[model samples]
Target: MSADGAGGVSRSPVERYTDRMVAALQRLEASDDPNLTFSRLIDVMGRSSHRLLILLFTLLNMLPGPPGFGGTIAWTTFGIALAMIFGWPIRLPALIGDRKLPLSLLIKLSERVAVAARYAARFSRPRLKWLTGAAATIPFGIFVMAISVVMTIPIPFINAIPNVGLCIMSFSMLNRDGVGLLAGLVVCLLGLTVAAAALFGAFELASTAIESIR
Candidate 1:
């Protein structure tokens, strides 16, 4: 319930942050508040690894279908991704970060993520482990940042593609699966291409309309 303890006790590394994330969600279920705030969720989850926090925000933004508060969620994704890139602790702006969310959604999301993570973990291993190393993660950070940008764009159903990409990247990162990371990058690039085409089409249409009006 409280922030992660400060006992300074030694512990082994947990490669997949998803495990910690699942535990955090379960703990939140026991809270009295039906609606959970972002700050509160952090507290409940304790001082977990950065990877876990990033995964949490990214998954919430990647839910398929109509988004509950799409803009808010997208901005939160942006903030978290920026943090990852900058090597800073994740922090959302007060507006998006402090907002309260329905516990039902969080609970459902956590369950679905847990299921997906399990399946993904099976095929993931330490092969090409260098991809996850410190220098390599910078590119990964940029990849995540690009996904966040795509998610924040106000195009219909546009976010869905990148959502899949980010999910793949997230799972791979958690499992330390280098091969998965490569696969994810491919997916992410494909999604970016789609998004770019959509944007170009929209711009051309707008330009045509303006010229016609002239």
Candidate 2:
């Protein structure tokens, strides 16, 4: 929970992250602060220890239920986490550059990821690169994506996994190197898979229960 200037009781961790990031975006929307540049943001983001934030963001929002009702939460979270690190939101599809925002963040992030992958290859072995990276992503990604899918079913267990996935994915992409990004992707894909399977099973069970009642 947080206290805004008005001093009202703040929302939960998930809500707080969303509020802060959304507010940042709204401010950017109204601003002429060129210092709010993407390059600077990327540099600044890299200079910080945001790995913890990334992990937490994944855990809180990508779980399941009420807040996860929207399809856009994941993508929205993706945007803000990237924006925070780079002073603006971004995606790989937008790597070509936007008229209003700098593409430097995109370029640098990709470069860094590639560099990290190459470095990792030295230890993990070229033959097992994808497996190594994907392995890291799978455990976390499964957890998140599972929540995302489950949320779509309107279950209240982990109601905000969609947002968490986006937040983590955003950081993974913005991280500037293949290793981290790939790991993040693993987390994403696995989570989605689990979510999908769970949804299917739940539907089947529900149908069976209904038939028996009839």
* Best-matching candidate per lDDT: 1
lDDT of 1 by residue, 64-176 (tens): 43555666676666666566667776655677668786667777887776676656544666567687766765677766766776777878776776777777776667666
The worst-scoring run of ten residues by lDDT in candidate 1 lies at 8-17
| CA lDDT of every candidate | 0.67, 0.41
Per-prediction TM-score to the true structure, in the order listed: 0.80, 0.36
For model 1 the local lDDT of residue 171 reads: 66
Q: What total of clashing residue pairs does each candidate reach?
A: 0, 33
Error of 2 at 25 (Å): 8.4
